[model samples]
Target: MAPNFGRSISFPLTPARSFSKSSRHVRSVSLPGTTSSHPLLANLHAHIAAVRSWIQDTASLQAGLANIHALHAALADLLLLPASVAALRCTTSNTGDRLLDAFLLLADAHQGFQECLLELRQAAAESRTALRRGDAGRLASASSSQRRAEKDLARLAASVSAVSTKCARLNLVAVSGEEAEMAYALVEAAAASAAASAAVFSAAASMSSAVSSCKKTATFIPAFARKSTAPESAEATVERLHALEQCFDECDGACDMVFRSVVQTRVSLLNIMTPTI
Candidate 1:
């Protein structure tokens, strides 16, 4: 099915700004699936699958967008926090208070993300119920709630990305060889995170449009079914879904790379923080 709805979505790629002279290259990594025997990888695969299933179950377009927004928020935190913490540690200005402030902000952001996820889940459940009962009014109410959640998620993503860019721009010198490596890795992670979030936002927008189209087409289904009429909207929805799925794949790859970089950053942080006798 071709997406001939005369509407096109464009994703503009911006070159990642280099923050250091080392020039770290970030490559997209493949996500591990359930077929993998490794416990960690298997668990990750299960977690992603569960989230995808939840999105699919919600029938509301806005609900799906809300889920994607939440997912992006989580990734943004993952992408930014380690580097922020590491950079803060390397700084010589107002050490103790700055460290405390950084951690507090991180905690607050994390808590906010969790709360948003809870709200989105509840909204999705309400949407599912309304859809099943064919209650148009309830569905509309749920859609409004989901839209608010989506906006909140978008705001959160933007805030995190801005903080990440700031952290990357900081010129703190690494105290040790291991710390330098970690700093470079953090830069790469930050770049990958920015690209991944963009892909997600684009995909979410496209999917939301497709879901709305699907809803509109549902109203005409009975008429089309009786008369054997070809539905152009249905075909357009299929095309959008295909594109959305591709975007998901790109996001997953970016996430995998970010996760690996995070691990590197953590190991370096641990080494720097450990007391040496």
Candidate 2:
């Protein structure tokens, strides 16, 4: 007897849970000596809030993609199989299986990316707290942790890019005619979303690098002042400050890119899951 391929996979389409809007609100932190809030610490808090928002959005996108996978599996089983064992023998190929495997790998990468984002957010929060408390040691530790998390993000981006390429070249020979065309279109949409996701990660990595550079420069400033026999030139001091400002600008630009790409990916996924009239 041929394997039963007629049964549909029963995956429930539940709406993703909404994250609390309050989580996006950054709490103001006051330094010990200053009555007013620290501006730099406040900015860090805001960055943390933005990271939290991205994490929630990515989670929703993951759920949507899972639903699409379930539907695609059902459609493949229905369209690729015929009554006779002879037909089964003729249709048996590994291309569909590989495509499905690629999808699963992509899903796993997304999960890993989410975890990295969570770690980054926590690290940022800790650094802000350390700043508020005037704990240089703790702040340095937090910065190191953030850098490590950013490294993981870079690796995940590379993985995503590889799997995305695999998905783009996926063979749909098992699904011929109109069915094949539709399947190809769906796969293309997925590929486009994956590309967008890779862009998001790349931009994020760039932002992290810029932040790390700025921190290093800032840390060296006090040491340079203490050790210097002669005072540093005014031009050099201005140049250093300019570099730090540029880093901040780069970080902000990258964050914006991530937000836009993520939104694009979500829209592509929505199209994949929704049926057209």
Candidate 3:
């Protein structure tokens, strides 16, 4: 059935629980099977499925980024619709606040991931230049920086996964009718998207670490032997760097889209929750 966009609807409120570290292990409320019957929600689920598929086969960075972008766009579309906005406003549980917190967490995670990519790009460029100049000291420093960036990305990915799991929980299934179903569906979809994003971050981190390992191997070769032989490891490092650079370039725009969409969705939630005279 179509959502009643024109009709006014409101839901009773439950007292919101405090968000804290202790709540991270709390299991989420189970959603009813009927929530999938909503057309917009079904569309969101399709996007979530696409993201999960890409997560499983993150062999193609381009495809992964595309799926992530689609998921975020779908979410933004769902939340911005008239009926959804109304549902958010009148949620009988604390779903609205939880969703707001989730979006904020996702926004931070995405930004951190973007910054890690930028730092990795810089390190890769420096490594290339250091190799061309045969500057052992500079190359070593660049390799260290690359490794550090990779670690940062790995940690951020873990952090995102934890936030998605903890922050997206919707408790108390007392909400009835279509509005309640929608509120639950939205949180579930967002949590799935967050998990997909974490996978992408982990992939990038692994790529960076691989390139760093190659560079370390290249650095240990004797200069005389290096002059007489083709530097296979060095060449491989360069290739990996090139591939990483390409991936980062492609991801830049996609990351921006997800960031903006999340931020806008948060703003919409805040607007609805704001007290208006």
lDDT per residue as tens, model 2, 154-264: 655555555445665555556554344334434443453444344445555555556566445444555557446223432343344344334434344334433443344
Among these predictions, the greatest lDDT belongs to 3
* Best first by lDDT, ranked: 3, 2, 1
Report residue 175 deviation for candidate 2 (angstroms). Answer: 4.1
The 10-residue segment of model 3 with minimum total lDDT is: 2-11
TM-score, prediction 2: 0.48
lDDT of each: 0.40, 0.44, 0.67
Runs in model 2 with CA error above 4 Å?
Answer: 1-95, 132-134, 223-277
Model 1, poorest ten-residue lDDT window? 1-10
Query: What lDDT does model 3 reach?
Result: 0.67
lDDT of 3 at 2: 16
Candidate 1 lDDT tens digits, 25-130: 2232221221334343334333334334443343343333344344334433433444334543665523223223323333333334334444444554555565
Error of 1 at 138 (Å): 0.9
**Residue pairs in clash, model 3:** none
Model 2 steric clash pairs: none
Count of backbone clashes for each model? 0, 0, 0
RMSD of each: 13.4, 20.0, 10.3
